[model samples]
Target: MRYYFVLTIFSCVFAYEKDLTFSVQAGKTDCFYHKVLPNEVIDLEYQVIDATHGELDISFQLADPVGRIIVADYKKSENAHRHTAALNGDYRFCFDNTFSTFSQKTVFFDLMIDTEENQDKEYDEDKEMEFGANSAESYMMRMRDISESVSRVRDNVSTARRLQELHSAHEARDRNRAEEMCAKVMTWSMVQIVLMMTVGATQVFFLKSLFEDRGSSSYKKLIPGLGSQ
Candidate 1:
């Protein structure tokens, strides 16, 4: 009976490791919805399998349930290999694969939370220790701050994408309009030249007829109008 009881106590104080599989997309960013509580840290570990085809940009934000940011930053090669969290409520991880338009890549994330009551196990069990109210309050405040930052980053990412698409669409429309205007100008110029030629031919024919008639005598009455001929 004592052995079984000891095992139960040990189980409650054990660390947990979770494995999550994420497939990187081509030309799009994927957001993973998650939130963490205080006293727990979300550790993200990733592996790039086929980085030759494309690259990956991973970022994370720790937030509160009501949407506030506490800690947020992109994963850099030097700093993000293993990340530790202080306080967290809703923690979101975003993966941007838009830069890798040529091929698809697979990435894995390992999340571990030190949930064991005595993870450090350094506290002397002979004496009881308790966290004061002040410490608890401080932890709560940190959680809220992290939540807010996460929400802001997420919003900014989406807004930036929308702006980029709008700019591209506007430029394409402007280019098409310019091409149409050039075609119209060329067509109108050809029409103008053809009309001018027809008028010139008509005037020449009338002048020649008048000159011949005046030399004979039939156009003697109209001779005054043929002085310039």
Candidate 2:
């Protein structure tokens, strides 16, 4: 029991570490990258100060981890309002210069990421790395391309393992909930059955007493009166 408790605690801590946060100085009002997980929500707070004293209106376009653009908005937006991440990878936050075309401007932003059920994916990643080592040299060469691509694949595998662990945990929780519900239903059914039986038994006894009383009354009425005799 103690070992189980310890393992559970460690798992929780490991999960907490999967969520990421990053802050970048105002470098460009063009594009930024944030790695997030599937089904997770990321909060992006961008503060662009007009250093050049230029009136700049900017909008952001969100990209999936595969560099695919998802959400595009030309209108100004405040801190990301509970924005849900579409995929489990690095998402791009693209800022567009709508009004002013300054030579070069700086934009600052903070990304707050919360991964969803990711700890399970890391297991798959470790196993993949072990397998990757034995692959042909050609395969390894392909893996090394773009440097960023390799990193992306690694991250994806990690996400997969984290998700696997979380999936099992979720199943266990569901089973526990189902068991509790079943027990409650059984207790309630038993109570109802006992109450019904008690009520039926009482009714039968009352009916028997009524019948006996009626018979005795009839006998008294039929008996001859002693004074008249």
Candidate 3:
């Protein structure tokens, strides 16, 4: 029971992963920040999942705590970045869609902060406790092995979850793009059908007018003596 309680606490402390989706309107920028400690590993992945006018691209920028740009990507559909925090502060992420006048972009992003130092410290603290010189030593060793195995499993699960989320985002983007293309194709096909019908009607009316017989008054307008004849 004690081991389970400690494991729960550990999991809670390391649950700083985030998955987010938001919109960046045309001529505007959207920014977010996450607080991180020094030496923590930061993993960021983002994709422009959907957009108006088939424009699935946006500018991304990441800035350090001291306002220095650590990474910048221009007009990208998807990107990922990994960095280690050198100072303790909030890291800024910005998505820029200012180049688009009327198209808005929908973005999906994943952020993960891994504190390996803290995990190592916790492990060291567990090791510092002196075990009795008896059967308790073997029991303690078994418990430690169990804890380590659980931690490994947890890490694997986290990685799998992140990959699944990213795959889902990609699927959504592709589905939206396909739907948009289908709509455009249908609209243009209808437009072409309407144009063809209009041209056919116009040609028929012109031919009929050309073949029409003129009355005596129309002839008189063309030749002065034709009406009398």
Candidate 4:
């Protein structure tokens, strides 16, 4: 009986991981719909990586249960927003790449729902420990210990995710800088090649002119009286 109760408590606090990885075409908007109940906490995190152009960010918006836009960001590469549902209905998160005429983007996002039901369960457990007739004090204390461990796990996961995102942003910046440098080097090399070819052709023409006979002298000798002068 004690073992089963512990299992139930652990299950109540465990959170599910939900994520999406997809591409949005140019000049289009893609949206994710989630149904949430009143007073539930919504935690959302997302990052957009521009695949085609440098610093090509995107826009996003969050709508409430009544379809009123609440959170909005423009030209953002990465952002996160969290809000509690005020009423029960569908919540919308949208990614807008419509500003880009020909460039598509890759987006990654995570959505987590933290319900009040979990809090209620924990409250009930505390009440049971305080006033129950046959509750083992050791079991109750163990349950609290396990709950604290779960909270720590959640915090560690959040920290790790943020660190990974920062690293990704750094990498993207470096990659863009490298590509720009390469393009400039290639253009400069082509210009040098063209200049060298032009100079070489000019030198060949000057050398040919210096070596050729005046042909004017031959023309004068062909006319009989012109040679005597």
TM-score of each: 0.40, 0.37, 0.82, 0.75
Maximum-TM-score candidate: 3
Query: Please, what are the lDDT tens digits per residue for candidate 3 over residues 24-54?
Result: 9999999999999888888989999999865
Compared with the true structure, the alpha-carbon lDDT of candidate 1 equals 0.51
Cα lDDT, all candidates: 0.51, 0.52, 0.83, 0.75
Q: Which residue pairs clash in candidate 4? A: none
Report per-prediction Cα RMSD to one decimal: 18.9, 21.9, 4.5, 6.2
Q: Candidate 1 lDDT, tens digit per residue, 1-229?
A: 3353234334444455555555666766676656555666555555443332423344444444556665455633212333345555556666666655665545555555655434324222311232331345464444335534544564476446545544554454456456666888999999999999999997886787777844564455445665456
| Order of quality (lDDT) | 3, 4, 2, 1
TM-score of 3: 0.82
Q: How accurate is candidate 2 locally (lDDT)?
A: 0.52
Candidates 3 and 4: which is better by lDDT? 3
Strongest candidate by lDDT? 3
- In model 2, the worst 10-residue window by lDDT is 15-24
Those runs of model 4 whose alpha carbons end farther than 4 Å from true positions after fitting are 116-135, 169-173, 180-184, 214-229
lDDT per residue as tens, model 2, 157-197: 75675555445544544564567668889999999999999
- Candidate 4 residue 105 Cα shift, in angstroms, is 2.4
lDDT of 4 by residue, 197-216 (tens): 99999788667666768754
